[model samples]
Target chain A: MDSTPEFVRLWTSHQAEIRRYLFLVVPRARDAEEVLQDVSVRLWEKWDQYDPNRPFVPWAIRFAYLEALKWRQRQAREKLVFSDALLVQLDASYEEEVPFLEARRRALQGCLRKLGDNERRWLWLRYGGHGAVKAEAVESGKKLRKVYYALEKIRVLLLDCVAGTLKQEGWSDA
Target chain B: MLKKTSRLDVLLGRAAEEMLSPEEATELEEILTRDPEARKRYLQYLDLHAELEESFQLHAVAGGLGSVFFPGVSGWRLWTGAAACAACGMLFASVAWAYATPVIQKAQRRTIFTENFEDRLAHQPTGLPRAPGAWSGDDASVVGAENGVLPKTGNSMLRFLRSTHAEENTPKSAWCDIYRLVELSTPPALGSRLSLSASFAVAPASDGEQFDIYVGLNALDTYPVQAPDLDTARNLSNTTLGRRLPATRNGKWHELSVDTQVSPQTRYVLVHLAMLRRVPGPSPSHVQFAGHYVDDIKLDLLPSNALPVKTP
Candidate 1:
């Protein structure tokens, strides 16, 4: 019952993976973050139930999945949301992408540095400042369509850069 | 030259922004099902979006990543800026530490037992009886939520009161000793350090009322009968380790943390919160006064390295 040290180690090691898994399951980042907190509490409460013989990531992911489902039920009235089947499909794909996503996260700083000054500023306005695309457009005196397109372009560039960096570092999907 | 925007790219962008309509979502699903390349690209874009969002949150918590990503800043200036940022970060962290030291200190120690007196009242019946997890002296009555003293954090607090009725020349002591047994799975070994802490407030009705609060650890099997006097309670065989706290007549909540050595043959520690009152009377009316209001009682077993080094 006194598994504090073991639980801390397991939780610290799998926190990022849990967060990413919740993010994939839940649509909104806020909802995903809330579910992450729930998952943390649930993990602590059920720490004694965890089997040391098995891998911790999958065990943690099961808790994350349950919490995400609970969150989805709470937000059932929201629009454009995925069904349980679709979520299961996404979760399956997410499990496969966890390793690659970690590498991409590592390469993100370099990729962000490679962005153009204007692109970086736009990114700051949108993601960094947490301003919406419309807000960015209003702030920069650009049309909403133009802001959206610009952001889309910047995202594509970042994605391409991350892929290139990973490939250069000899990271392949296979 | 800029590459033309593909349908998949447009769908991915809308999906990232959560702006995809039902029609667009259906089309995107069709594309994802039909083309493996589109599905791969979609997952990658989603992953990138999540990474960027998470990075922003991380940067915000780390006091912003502005200095590291400033455009056109040269080597010396960057180093200087980084150093300045580091200095600012240190300053900000120090201030945060000052505000969060108590919470950080509590979080660092492993809690062996904690009772906030929040849930105990709800489980108690209507009459003034002992709390669910607490055992009180014969003279003590645990006031339930209805007439209970207001809690520091939760809905109720452990209100210990003793009333003395002395006829002419009889000088008697009124005391309330409340203790709860905290069964530990891995009990502290002999000579191991432990800490007992609780916030208490005394509300003496008159100047003649004297309040004494004692917090301590006792062995599980050793049950000590409630003693009428403070000296008798202190010298009890069950009380392996304890400290008598100073009276707080100001009526403000004062926190008392006592460090003591763990005794042998202790599978569980009894966290005792005793409120003793010595009332000297030559009065016409019965003297009534509240002894102590206790809340947030906690006991922690300190790690060996956390113990204070004794100087020779």
Candidate 2:
């Protein structure tokens, strides 16, 4: 029996979640993506060994965690965001919060639409790409503090809105 | 203490923006280790940043490429043959261009009319006391809100004036209306949705009277010579009035809008901005229009049929 078909379906569907988990453990986004590529290849090769009874994500995430740890060792000491011990502890906590995080991510899409036009633009410039926010601030002659203040307000609003939506849908108190 | 709270907040903000230095990163890790609450806050901010980064990233989906691809290369070296690489690249580009010809068109919003009251001289040509296309009714002028708080866009807005205009509203009106007219040379195609959006603002004393505000639209072949009684009298079958709700007294600009399909017969659209209770002190009137204003009126047309799009 070819496990490639089922494995491909599962991997593609949950690739973003795995990438997000890797981002939490890996400090740099590019580093996370590099580790993610290796993990994908590793998972593909080991698909036949995966036990179908257990949850696919928790099983696959373990591989990602180990791969990220290896990548962190290859990086310069200054690049690591946390110590190895702290990363390991946080990985366990993140594994339990996967479902809740998925819910919050979905709610965030709706909350994004509720933001004002300026907030959306600022958010895109700040996070959409490297150095985009600084370029915009300099070109527009806006104070850096004012830009950060607007972004902070938007984050708080989205967090509150996401919490309210989750409550309304009986997702969680958060 | 606010000092400690602000410390965690600033660190989280720096992390989310990808601006944290190595030193700050160490501080952040120590704080997260010492304070569980700080750790939770860090997770929330990181989660938001991660999702945002996901959305910002390029999403390229290439379908049906597996069968057409050449066999996987072994120990590929880009500099091995530059001339051959250029030829191969051209071939791939041509093939991809032909295969990707079928594109999905994007939905569009066409702006028909937009006014922020910055330019007040553009009045509708009307031959009546007050009509839909022209700024009708009494005691309303475009003035800038002091302290720059009320106007939706620019500094200027249309304020409902109460100077000797209370007597005029009583005869046949319950609204002080400002009019804007958009005349279409040809009626919009069927199934096209005409959307009207306008922002209203008000600032009143806590004990001040309540003033009602409404937005109305009329789609007709021609403008009425005389201004129609917008609230009290039954309007023509083609009229649509927004709900008569009390203006919020929170000193914020609130947006109100009305959207309806433009039938094949609609030649002109009359946008009406009306406010009620514009008189002074007691008796027939309770709350007077203290700082009731309207600004930033816009008209948009969304075509249902697939249209040409420059953006997706």
Candidate 3:
């Protein structure tokens, strides 16, 4: 806890992951940052709450979930808005990404290199934003379905490459 | 099982992005409970989704945005950022695993509540001397078993409208949401009048009638404590009465304020604006009826009885 340098380092390394976790949990971009900041502050204040032995992701998730709930509650009282069903839906949607991010990223790097330039760009465009796809589809004069299928094929190729790399990396257990 | 796992993976991906159908979601939940390995795989997949999201973060754009694999960049920066994020992660992990005590947890929970209160206040409408957005229908029938006024039932400030017609179809006196009644532990000191300086949109129904605004003490009075009606309410020299602003072209925000006098007797003083429509007229459908998007409302509560006015 005394090591400010260590804390800053930790924040840098996991900031992306924390941001990702918050993005999954929060609907708005701004809210995700707020959650991340709140989580960081809470982590700082309650440094004693952490056990050095455990993984950080789960703990961060717990904090993120708590923040998300508080966000919901605030929305409820101030706006007196949101139906129970919508709340349930939002909760269900928030944290669906707990398990495979690291391995997949590791796997994806090897496969992403194998893609053709166009395919890589296609992947980037498809995953970029809905606007990107709409723009690309119009420019290419291609049906949305065709663009979707092409993207899916590229994703499958990448997944296959990743799986092959994992095998080479001795992840036979997976 | 493999087929089920495959389907789970696809559904899980969609679910991470909140594009899953209801039926697919139900299946996914069932798989989560019954299959541990599948659940593990799903969690791993969620991590991937997180990575994808992080890749586009603004901070990720540091050192000139381009591809993740930009050439001529010092490897040290990557290592440093990685080390920093990892250290932050570990510090957080240590705190969560080691130091979290029950006493600390309770205190943290209270702090969370307080912060939540402040954060929420940013978007909440201020209550009047009585309370902002208080229901004013007749409540003499529900007499209290104890001292003070019997608590009002139904038509609570927080209510879920079943449909647009729920208000009209429902009984006029129906309490929309129930409030938790609490007896004050000590003498309830009069809170100072909140200096209201915020915009509130007031869109009347198609009939062009406006919602009524009031400042009053308690809920039983047929009229407001300060302003009996709109014209009278507007004419008060000392009061902070505002003319209703026009609707936004694409729903622009509005602001209003009231720095009224408050006293210990002002147990229930308030400034309220009701979105009322003419009988058989166009109903101000939804929250838009009150002529404003009341969400993301902010209120600053002043110290109690800090009114500048000298009461006679």
Estimate every model's Cα lDDT from 0 to 1: 0.60, 0.61, 0.39
Cα RMSD to native, each candidate?
Answer: 24.2, 20.0, 24.1
lDDT of 3 by residue, A1-174 (tens): 254554454455456666776564453456677778888887777656765323355576677667766676766543322233443444454333222234457567666566666775565454433246556688779997667556545544555566577556433333
Regarding lDDT, does 1 or 3 come out ahead?
1
Model 2 chain B: weakest 10-residue lDDT segment is B70-79
- Candidate ranking under DockQ, highest first, comes to 1, 2, 3
Chain A alone, TM-score for each of the models? 0.80, 0.81, 0.59
The candidate that wins on TM-score is 1
The lDDT, on a scale of 0 to 1, for candidate 1 is 0.60
- Candidate 3, residue B273: Cα displacement in angstroms equals 66
When 2 and 3 are scored with lDDT, the better candidate is 2
What DockQ does each prediction reach against the true complex?
0.10, 0.08, 0.05
Q: Indicate the worst ten consecutive residues by lDDT in candidate 3 chain A.
A: A93-102
Instruction: Give a tens-digit lDDT track for model 2, residues B18-85.
Output: 67888898898888777656666666677877877555332111111111121121111111221123
**Candidate 3, residue B267: lDDT:** 25
Q: Tell me what TM-score chain B of candidate 1 gets against the true chain B.
A: 0.47
Q: Model 1: runs farther than 4 Å from truth?
A: A4-13, A53-55, A70-78, A132-136, B33-36, B60-68, B71-312
Which ranking of candidates, highest lDDT first? 2, 1, 3
Residue B308 displacement in candidate 1 (angstroms): 34
